[model samples]
Target: MASTDSHSCVVYLVDPQDGKKGTVVPDRFRRLAIADGCGVVGLESADEDGGSQEELTGLIVAAIAAVMERQDPAELGGDGRAKVGAVAKQAGFKVTKVQFDEAWPKYVDGLGADDEDKDGE
Candidate 1:
């Protein structure tokens, strides 16, 4: 998340109480915010090439899938998490492992049973 200052804008899942923000907010939250008519605050970053929500979502998913594809699930450990973070960055999102871990559950839950079953959950 970028520093909260006069110029900085809040993204999707900003906790209002503390004013904490995340740039790579989960799609579920983003959609709800928009559907509820909440204003979206976007920051202009020199590194970021602004993109459509669908495109960005595809990029993020592809990055994760690519990393998972190269590793056996049983063998994936801390290194796997690191690889995911790196892959996300390569795809243009500055995602950390902790952030990914936190947001992933929300993203998964939003998909519900159909997606979960596909994952053998």
Candidate 2:
């Protein structure tokens, strides 16, 4: 999992290999930050080495769609998590954990002010 703006925005990427995880984020999967609100937008790409990047991408997209189509917003979170898990299971790729806090500390600090406020109270 990768977080930006102090963990307000996070992105998760699952590798279609051994499932090893890393959290330094790139611009590609930035849309995942919206997962809690409007749902996440996922994009997947695979190399020609029998990797299931395409499949995984499709699964993520489908998951997002499934979550968005839910009648209640409260259900979106659970549905999204389920969809992500499904994609990982169906695709032969391992998921990479990326975090913006480690990648962009300044950004995270700035974004996390709200968290600080909540914690302070």
Candidate 3:
């Protein structure tokens, strides 16, 4: 939960019955919430930048809400997406899905070695 002395925000990753997980990013604009039943909640942030705590809070809130309304965390990277989803939910943002093929290469250190040539072939 991200919070100030008077307000706080919480994000939740919910796994409803059907053996699938869902994410809920709460908008910072929203302070109170009621969970439906199954899910995990994570708090993202709580601080003001340049005296715009309220604005930042609102952006977080909207982003989380957008994510919950438009994304499926399972599609991104399973648990990682779930965690991000929770944070987004708490902050009120939507999870943006990108093509893995395009994004993976940038972060992947090395391609797997050929099985027959394990000696750095």
TM-score of each: 0.30, 0.25, 0.23
**lDDT tens digits, residue span 1-121, model 2:** 3444444434335444546443344553433433222222233334342233333344444444344345344443452332333333332233332321122233335447858999999
Which stretches of model 3 miss by more than 4 angstroms?
1-51, 75-82, 85-121
Ten consecutive residues with minimal summed lDDT in candidate 3?
A: 34-43
Q: After superposition, how far is residue 75 of candidate 1 from its true place, in Å?
A: 10
Clashes of 2: 18
Ranked candidates (lDDT, high to low): 1, 3, 2
lDDT (Cα, tens digit) per residue for candidate 3, span 8-54: 54444444544444445455423333221222233233532322333
For all candidates in order, the CA lDDT equals 0.49, 0.38, 0.38
RMSD, every candidate, angstroms: 13.0, 16.7, 16.5
Order of all candidates by TM-score, from best down to worst? 1, 2, 3
Query: Which one wins by lDDT: 1 or 3?
Result: 1
The best candidate by lDDT is 1
Candidate 1: C-alpha RMSD after superposition: 13.0
